[model samples]
Target: MTAPTLFHVAILRTLLIVAALVALESNRLEAAAPEPTQKIASAAAAFLDTLDDTQRGKVSFAFNDAAQRIRWSNLPVSMAEHRGLRMGDLKANQRDAVMNLLATTLSKMGYEKVVGIVESDEVLRKQSPKGAPPFGRDEYFISFLGKPSATEPWMIQFGGHHLALNITIAGEQGVLTPSLIAVQPAKFTLDGKTIRPMGRETDKALELVQALTDEQRKQAILGSQMRDLVLGPGHDGETIQPEGLKTSTLNEAQRKLLLELIAEWSGIIHDTAATAKLNEIKANLADTWFAWSGPLEAGKAYFRIQGPTVIIEYAPQRLGGDVTMHIHSMFRDPTNDYGKKFAGK
Candidate 1:
């Protein structure tokens, strides 16, 4: 071949720069400890060690138990009656250990968000009528599916009214899906500061919707009005025909907003797993879809982000007097909910 020209040299230099950037991103995603799986497994085992035989028997379940896998809801404990060790029944130290395990499993913001959801229940409890269903942070329950192990598949089920966190762990992987995160009186005061449990979720969604062009907005809005989540609790192992504006059609700026919106849910898991899961979602962003229902400018609305590996929905409850005050949302992976892909279930 003839000697390379100046144009060829310039092209080669540009390609090398792009390759370096790709390698840098890959390293960032893989930078966590070799195994967050082991850390979480150990924390779980430590939590179990704090329990007595009776507590252990009540808190543990067969990993593949179909019923337990689907036994989570957004209703209050008095109405739905969750299975597992009630946080209210645990000793103070045991409760602390439970919190420790939760902190270990979720990202810092995620842990704060989960705590805020639980605390929001207390706020609702005070405002609820005397005959309303019971509500309180203490009513939350925690259970383990199968024994905690670094190399084996298992899960953590923790939830109460308006919250359900189903985290599955297998090896270096962590999964959070089929989770129900809701809150009544969505805004409240805690320690003289305002706390909105699902604040980022709502704000980011609205920002993304508003950023779209009028034509794009038309494509994003669904044909039907969605008053509540279509794939909320009890709708496990279900798939819906993808609807709304395809991510492929979005401009670069709009797509970035979409990923930020997705991170509000997927980022709740531990950093190691969340980074990997996000990278996976980003890789498939072109195939994802974003659907919205109800108001496009503000107030209460419903939105969804769906892709090959993930499904997320946010809906404001209509039963509550002010729709904005009560919100219900879901995050799920159609292919890997409960880590079934890793567990071979």
Candidate 2:
């Protein structure tokens, strides 16, 4: 190989300097990025920056507005008016910003679940009966109960027909409670891939129930039928007396199955937040109860997992033609809904 001329050497030197500058800039950006604990708040702030004053006012509410905190539902906006900036009204960039906040707040699977639920509504939109309320992905709304801060309490309320996520953030903790995760067409196809918003929730619960011994099943089954959610939507801060078999009775294998089932809900938030939440749930597993009210052979069923800190219910809507086609599930932290404990309500 020939030695490079002075001109070639100078050009190579210039290129190396440019590459170094680029790497330095990339490193600076990476360092400036918020940590996992702060991402949700940072994303919320970034979203706010994208909005004008009027839009910001529409999306923000006082932290102490108790009414606003519980003003969420699984009903369409036409039936229950939402107090936030409508997804449909947002500009492209603004809408993207809101989605970014959601992605930042929830785990990958959780974010996909939310999107799937919304897309299922879009499916419902096209199949709506005459004069029925509107249904679509764009019908969802996003609101913030307080200014987003990493160390102080705040909330993010995002929901629409058949879905509601009430995520509260305080310090390094992020709580997803009193959230409704539901879908009208429980199964659908998006981008050519089959999507079931609550698929894992259904499958995992089924696996747990199926793993039960004969005696265990008898203890787990409920006498009465459950057609809908008892603690969904408006039923916040309330819990039914736990029924069914206590998790403490489960063998180690069955216990593991139960924890996996619970994770379908607790693991919906960002991993860092989910890990803390899961640890608490595991600690209380001994006191947790698992109850089922449906067929043991096959098909959809209604099940409830109630413990000291968590109450999760999965009820497939029976009145909606095909019971398996519509589903509603609730996730609540009885002691910390809306971060009440963290905020010292």
| Winning model by lDDT | 1
TM-score of each: 0.88, 0.88
- Go through the candidates in order and give each one's C-alpha lDDT: 0.89, 0.87
**Candidate 1 C-alpha lDDT tens digits along 43-145:** 8989999999999999999999889888999888878869999999999989999999999999998999999998989998888899988888899999999
lDDT of 2 at 208: 90
Error of 2 at 127 (Å): 1.5
lDDT for each residue of candidate 2 in 60-161, tens digit (9 for 90 to 100): 999889998888888888999788999999999999999999999999989988988999999999888989899998899999987887667888999989
Q: What number of clashing residue pairs does each candidate have, in the order they appear?
A: 0, 0
Deviation (Å) of 58 in candidate 2: 0.6
The clash number for model 2 is 0
